[model samples]
Target: MTYTVNCSILLTELPLLERPAAAKTAGFDAVEFWWPFETSVPTDVEVARFENAIADAGVQLTGLNFNAGDMPGGDRGLLSWPAHSTEFQDNIDVVAGIGERLGCKAFNALYGNRIDGESAERQDALGAENLAKAAAGVARIGGTVLLESVSGAPNYPLLKARDALDVIARVRTESGAENIRFLADFYHLAVNGEDIAAVIEKHAQDFGHIQIADSPGRGAPGTGQLPLGEWIARSRALGYEGYIGLEYKEPAETAFSWAIRA
Candidate 1:
């Protein structure tokens, strides 16, 4: 099985720019990341430095997240938020530029948490619109836009494979953008009470990318009760031939021990 390190969550012991090289040295040829910049439109120099870090490290950036506003501050994403619509739209080119430069084709777009005053119906509509725009932005490279179901954020709406797929279907029907797809992150799904085996059996082919950590503590595979190796095997058996992102939270030094054991 091919694995890609998620530098944003794992490898936190090192500076952001250094994680790609660290991951490369740790025996991974591919990596993925959440938005690394503080702003949606970072200076060109900043973008170059980020691009160069991955290039210098000789690791392929297999997947990336479009700027989901203030992740550390609890902003899940900008897609459905009315106030941040411009910010989200402004980010599309920058994201596409990075993807173009690094040969990364999969872009994950987090659906924003539901606002207190905003109607759920309106938010869903806005999210679909922004997702279509994102789909169009990366269409030049034949790239895919990913929608994910997240856990732990109480206000965030997407909590199941069906939820994400519903948005994807809306994007396809409303905008005629065929490039949007589901990002199947097993840890979040399991935490949200999804049946991993059933999801794999039914929608494995619909997944544009896959991310994993064990459930409960969201630690390395062995730290939780999830049968990660078996789940991965089932996904592959169902024809999921893509990078499985190692997006767990654990000390970097010991993170890959589970892989060694497997």
Candidate 2:
């Protein structure tokens, strides 16, 4: 089993480029992140800075997210948001370029929250179209595109495991690319009231990536009530062979061994 830290959430005390090394300091060989910069269009210099960070830190960029507008302000993803379609297009190559340089093979395309005044049907249509479009580029790069659920945000379309699986199926059909897959974040599923084992028992094959954060507080495994170790064991038993992303609030003391071994 491989465990990858999510720098966008953990090790955030450092600059964007510096976070990779911080993850390494915490004993992680693989790291993933949200779009490092705010803009969908960052200059070549900025892109290079990010590339060098990962290289110098000696860690792999296992997974990445395409630009999703202002993440802190609740812009979950741009692919589905109509106002950001041009920005999303402008960002595809930039993101793909980063993945190519790192030899990373997974990309997470967040389906954005609903926009005001736009009908849900139209937004859903736009989301499917954009998902298909992103799928083509990701496939060309020999990588799989991921769709994940977010917690507490009803406006975000992919809030449930079933919801994400639906989009995965639609994107595969819409693009004729079977490379699309589900990103199963157990914390989000638990937050949304889905039974984890049931999701795995039924659709384990649909999950391309899995992330864990204990429920009640989205903290490290030992700090909460979630049976993450058990869940991880179950997922492996179900034949989930993907990376387990460590995406949660940093504990007061960064403990690394158990998470990796689990």
Candidate 3:
């Protein structure tokens, strides 16, 4: 598999509008992000500006996330949150618009963590409903809904490979469509105590998108314990053919070095 830089995590030192170009200069042909704007409801002009940036930069947008509120502030996701259901729905068209415009084929729909007083069943129902809508929209463009796991926050519900796959199964059943698939982020899985090798052997076919970072520090590969190159080989060995998103923290200048594993 080749590499696609996740601009949201890498090149943090550059302006948002410039990250795609930076990724390109770093030798990446594709990139991903977690909602580039504070609100998923960016104006048409704003969206157009981003589109132009990518065009001018000459990089393919591989994936994007639905608005998840404040990622750095511990907001796990928006769709599954009862209060943010409308917000999540409102962002769907905007997301799909950009995806269609950019020819991006992957979308990550995070399952919101539990609200203080809300029941899991209620939130879960909302997640299913919202994801069904999202799946239908992306399916129009032949894109896939990525069920991903997040780590570094205890409240985030989907932290394991099985956790993400279970949610994917539930969404598929509810939507009655097969456009949804697993987004296997190796860093999160390892930190959550999953055996990466075993997960790959069993669920490789379910993975529509894959991301990586070394665990323990969520830093550049050499700064952590994961044998990312070996695991990537394991993934390819099992019939997985997809871009591996470089999702980790590193100096923008040195970030591309980790792509050696790709």
Quick one: best TM-score, which candidate? 1
lDDT of 1 by residue, 1-262 (tens): 7999999999999999999999989888999999999999999999999999999999999998999998988999999999999999999999999999999999999999999999999999999999999999999987999999999999999999999999999999999999998899999999999998999999987789889998789999889899888888888888889999999999988989888776
Clashing pairs in 1: none
TM per prediction: 0.98, 0.95, 0.96
Per-model clash counts, in order, read: 0, 0, 0
Q: Once model 2 is optimally superposed onto the true structure by TM-score, how far is the C-alpha of residue 24 displaced, in angstroms?
A: 1.6
Full-model lDDT for every candidate: 0.94, 0.84, 0.87
lDDT measured at residue 55 in model 2 versus the true structure, 0 to 100: 96
lDDT of 3 by residue, 39-74 (tens): 869988889998999989999999999898998788
Candidate number of the best lDDT: 1
Give RMSD to native, each candidate: 0.8, 1.7, 1.3
